[model samples]
Target chain A: MPGGPVNDFLDQVETCVPALRRYARALTRNADLADDLVQDCLERAIARRGLFRPTGSVRAWLFTILLNIYRNSRRAAGRRGETVNLDSVAEPASPAPQPGHIALAELARAIDALPIEQKEVVLLIALEGLPYAEAATILSIPLGTLMSRLGRARSALRLATGVTAEPHLRTVK
Target chain B: MSAVTHDDLMAYADGQLDPGRVGAVEAHLAANPDAASEIALMRRQSDALHALFDPVAAEPVPARLRARRIAAAQRQRRGRSWSWAVAALVLLSLGVGGGWFARPLFEAPAASAVLIADAINAHTVFVAENRHAVEVGRDDSAHLASWLSNRLDTTLGLPDLSAQGFALVGGRLLPGEPQLGGRAAQLMYEDAAGARITIYVTAALPDRQPAAQLASLDGAEAFYWANARITCTVVGTLPAERMQAVSQAVYGQLTDGDVSAPRYRS
Candidate 1:
């Protein structure tokens, strides 16, 4: 067999790594599990090789694969009753930002609390930095559906984290 | 722009609006603080979310997530799988067990194997392409490079293959095994004999190890390798000697003394 496709796959995975980790992080709410998820995703992708290819952008294709793997693993873990806590793993953005709303720990929990749909939209757009078009394609939803999910995700975070107060941190950009 | 709907406003906030409508949205925003606040709120949310997560992108990607490693793991996997297949064949020969009886255990072709095959297959198909070949012309190398690079999420360098008498024609990113790496880039090069060669590049696997392998397939001689930086497959339908020369030239130039190049036997 030619080594070309393997090379191509490797290169593609390299680019998708950050986004995968980010999405994994968002999904599992555990950096270690998220990385494990990413590793599993890559292993499965490489091991499976060329069989899973479907027509369309590979970005969407890869995301779909990763999402499926993540869901399946989660289901398997649930069945096994392997439970773990994520509270101790939480880290703040800065030494001291404020007492309440701007606290990143609170925000992380809020994000963790979002409905899976809203969470998926936020990660695809904000965390993964995927284009709306690509993210919508990956989610297999209308662009409008994606936007609503994103909108709801943000609103929920603002309420959940008690960050309702305007930042007053206006940016001229 | 005339009393833009919520969708239109959302699109504008996301920076997805057409240029013609941008001014109109701005006009609307200036007139409506309420709408502006909504947009501002969305932007802030985006900013905060980015603040919370974008760092993951810059975090020195873990070695386990490296492309080179993933590719290496994949190659090893293929070898192991082939051996497993051989063992299964042996078992069947002996009529000892039912390992072959299970379909899911050994039936489906792995994505990596298929992608590598497809990349080689596509390389053969298009390397023979002549006039009106590549979707993007080589003259627009800068655009093509940037576009494909952005799509593939890795730096794309058009290796100077001129010394081998193969001038770059252009390249197009193709979707490959999403499981393997998700995307593939095909760059076409033409030589004086009207012969062609293609260099296929993809993101490294999670393992990011290197490999040296050569596979002759479908009238094309393919020299493929993986490295920390990228996985490149050079494919063309040239005579074995000519293909080796081309692959060697490509390996030499693209590596640019950054690392040792792979040697192929056949």
Candidate 2:
């Protein structure tokens, strides 16, 4: 908090940039546009730093910024109805590995195919490693909602990625 | 053969189990093959999820994503915006003051200071402009004199200083800060030696009273006066005696031989 609201706001945004970028990337599924979303989010955050000081955690504050910007773009796109999603989840290059479980690429597609709400929570908690409480706070949902979303997301991912038996399950310890 | 709930199994797979609660869960899972299989699927799911996105957290953060730089840019942008607001406010005050005083325009104690500052600033900006040495050329001295006199409501006459080895180099109209007439006409005079002096004049303040004083400010000597007609500040770096002589000559003629005019003594 040294150097007042300006500095504190900056510090907060800085600490959250990476997470914000990752979330944007997951939401938009495009690296460049994700960063664009991040940049716009930062711009709004900087412009309205004064509004946040006594309110949200800097992380939640930033996520709120990113989420609003994302939603607005989505709404605008709805108006245009021309979304190509041209960059939806590029396939990573790698030789295919073992079976009995869902292949990683198929799993990725499954995660991508989940509705936005489910995908957002699963990525925030399971992927981004944000706690359920923090994810709930960031998403403005009750913890139960966050838990249900996570549960449904995992169930959807299992169905989509293939829930066939895999021997590695016993070695988790 | 035990009762390990799905919530507990999911929590354990996601690393949410308390250390103390883990032993009991592990014992229960070890004894139940079906329960163990369910726990295994959950662990595999968590692992697959991590395999997909954890590399992101491990990747070298791009420069654009660097927390410090983003923060720095954001802070700078915010500070710049706020400082701009402050600057606009100050400029607004200056503009309002410029309109309010509306008389000789600048208040007295402050008049000399402001005039000296303007004299210095104007000298700096235009002394280098050869073709535009004066806003109104000396050749059009009549217009320069009349226009300024009307604007300031003072009887202003351009002095012919040829008798004193100096010639009117011309004059320019300048916007002065409010306290100092808000509008000023700077009359530049140069001697045979290229030595220069300027007389800054403004309209008779609304008070219509006359006041005269002298001071040395920031390397410039200023002789100033306010009359029912106008306020004039004479500024230069000449010696005290030279300044007095120039003031006497400027006052003598610019005042148009008004017998009640003040005398010359530093």
Alpha-carbon local distance difference test for all models = 0.67, 0.66
Chain A TM-scores of each predicted structure, in the order given, are: 0.79, 0.83
DockQ of each: 0.25, 0.11
Q: Residues B1-266, candidate 1, lDDT per residue (tens digit)?
A: 26677766766867777778888888888998778877776666667666766676668776567555565445545464553454344334434336323442343334334445566656655765676568799889999988877776766778887777888888887766666677888999887877777888887654454443454442455566555556778877777667767766766665554532232111
Per-residue error (Å), model 2, residue A110: 0.8
For each candidate in turn, the TM-score is: 0.54, 0.50
Docking quality (DockQ) of candidate 2: 0.11
Candidate 1, residues A1-173, lDDT tens digits: the string is 33465556655666778878877876777778888888888777766656756456555666877888877887899898955557534475477554322556666788878988889888777666678888888778998889889878877877776654345532122
lDDT of 2 at B123: 55
Q: Provide i-RMS per model in Å.
A: 4.7, 8.9
Candidate 2 C-alpha lDDT tens digits along A15-41:
677778777876776677888888888
Q: Give candidate 2's TM-score.
A: 0.50
